[model samples]
Target: MTFVHWLAGQAGQTFASACVMTILVLMLFMAMKLYKSYRRNQTHLVLIIVLPLIIIQNGVLISLSDPEWSASPYLHIGYSFVSLLSFIIINFVFMKLYTGPASRLKGMPFFLMAIGLVVVTAAQIAYKPEMLSGPIAPGGVDLLALDFYGLILNFIILLNLRGVDQRINYQTSLIVYFVYQLSDMADSYVFHGEKPMLLIFIHLLPIVYYTLLFLLLFEWVLERLMMTFQSSITDGLTSLYNRRHFNKKAEQLLRDMKRIAIIFCDIDNFKKLNDTQGHHKADNVLKQVAEIIKEETAGIGTAGRYGGEELLGLIAAPGVKPEDVAEAIRSRVEKETMVTISVGVSISREGTSIAEIVSQADEAMYQSKTTGKNKVTLHPSVSQKRPRSESEGSKRSKQA
Candidate 1:
């Protein structure tokens, strides 16, 4: 139960360091993958380079945990230098990523931090050159020098950046790392390894710290993947599902239920709207109509952008009428926006393919467009559906 034999001893410290090293190695591989995927992004390139340097620091700490080993004073200085500077620069990389990947990070903050790190490192050797004789562990006062500066630097960066950037996703990681650094600083100045429990905790902090950092990178990767997926499945302008994804949803719905419906909407005189009001204005109108369709179909079904000025809704709720949904879409477009729409709805039968259903809806929509604009029409094959007049749809919308 006690840590005296294992945790407080060299074995425990080495084990902890080994865990940190393992986490660092995994982070390195992730960094490599990111850099490989985005070769042009200098931020990833910086991560790929610095992670290996930090990993080597952990490897050295593991090797030197044994009491029998001795290292030169220069080696001690190198250890602190590598650990401090690499992590500080990596924090700069964090800021760069938040700004955007393509942004060059040659700002005043980076320049000042670079100069400050060099100055602190120089002061460490100047104040007390790693003694030529009796190479030993950095004492309490020694930690107050460069290591303390590193801690303060990180704290300041996070404090200021928290105000400047609202999208720092790795906040938990930063907090854990702050506590880890604080604990290490506490061990050096307060207990000085006299308390085995605190020493064990200090040794374990690296594992917790590095593990949190690794997870942060993993989370960032997942977020990027999600954004890519959303971009692929959704229209960039209206943010509705694209034609391909809409069809996919239709197929999936047809499989799950015995009946489904497709409401196809086409904006009236959309080419005139685009030509008269310009692209930006026409895009707003299209987006507004898409929003009406999405709102009317919420929960019962999904809405999508089928093409230019063309949007769709797929209804799968049992007992819900497709014609009613189509009318609501048409009435809303007429009342709410600068333009009106002609809509046609087709319900899926036992043997209808998604293409066939969409074709039927399109056919019905063409009939409405030819007869009158701003109307709802049902497929002729649906015996019970009565095509709603523009006045009836408007009255029903007013009633609702």
Candidate 2:
């Protein structure tokens, strides 16, 4: 056999293999999605699973049908219709899942659909009946029309991706799939009947596309799990570490540090304020106090919401006094919010446990509350005759 004949046979076999592989992978993906949807009771996953099945059918029909039959205008039109309809359905499903019905489309999808319709109609009008007598040829007007149709379908899919949550996966998969379709369309024209080497490479595009999509999906699932773990440790009301996380992290900090400080802060008259100003205003005050604490303790330590109307700060920096950190936070809360915070400082020494440090700070904070509403106090063991900073004294006098 001539080289051309051998090359053609190899190309044909490769194309067949590629089609089979794509179908199998797609079916597996569909089954996976189906199981997930069933477990989660989410009906929306049905559309994505079904759409791929339709595309798989199209691929199978194209691979097995006679070239002349596939090239016929009626079959060509039917293929385009089925492919376009699948994209439309899948696009709607994605848009509904991500953006909701309110912003599903602002006319872009419909406009693209109209454009695709015009291209297909124009292709049918420009078709020559005489061309049917010859073997399948490249660059026909009908092929151009189909290419345009596929392009519009891809554009619609991309449009659905707008406003999707960035952390969620599948954005990359959608883009890869779009590029794969376009490359496949272009390859049909570029490698038709000759160039077996290039055709073999083109045939591998689906494998690459699906593999990348699988990897991206795995990454997305991992990200979601991480986010869930973070949320568990975080305080939803203030976006700070919760008491549970604070306990765990403070223990870790103490293990690595020779000197550490714990500052406990309680909002003064918070219950009265909540009763008078309402829960909404009380929430705002809590959020503002949390922000102040976060800013003051950043880098020097970790801060968290210990409980209602109370916040905790842990500072492990050498040469840093717990009183100074407490005063900084007390001053900021007084200046920034309508309410005042009483802060208590406790210094960690050799063989001191985290529980002991927290207890000392809490007692000191209670002393501030009992003596005066908005003052910073230190546990008697760590208290010294050191004069308070001028700024801290001034802020306290203003509160007085």
Best by TM-score: 1
Local error of candidate 2 at 263, Å? 0.5
Query: In candidate 1, what are the lDDT values of residues 1-400, reduced to their tens digit?
Result: 5656579767888888888878878887888888878765777888888888887887767655654443456566677778877777777766676555355445577668778878887876777754645667534236467777777877777676543233455565567777877877777777777778777877887788778667767877887889999999999999999999999988999999978999989998999888988999998988898899999999899999888887899899998988888887887788898788888888889988999999999988887788776788889877455676688645443211
**RMSD for each of the candidates:** 3.4, 5.7
TM-scores of the candidates are: 0.90, 0.72
Instruction: Please give the lDDT score at residue 385 for candidate 2.
Output: 54
Off by over 4 Å in 1: 68-71, 99-108, 137-143, 163-169, 384-386, 392-400
The lowest-lDDT stretch of 10 consecutive residues in candidate 1 is 391-400
Instruction: Record all residue pairs in model 1 with backbone atoms less than 3 Å apart, i.e. clashing.
Output: none
Q: In angstroms, give how far residue 258 of model 2 lies from its true place.
A: 4.7
Model 2, CA-based lDDT: 0.68
* Candidate 2 C-alpha lDDT tens digits along 328-398: 88877777788888888888889988889999989988888887668778888786653233354544544
RMSD, candidate 2, Å? 5.7
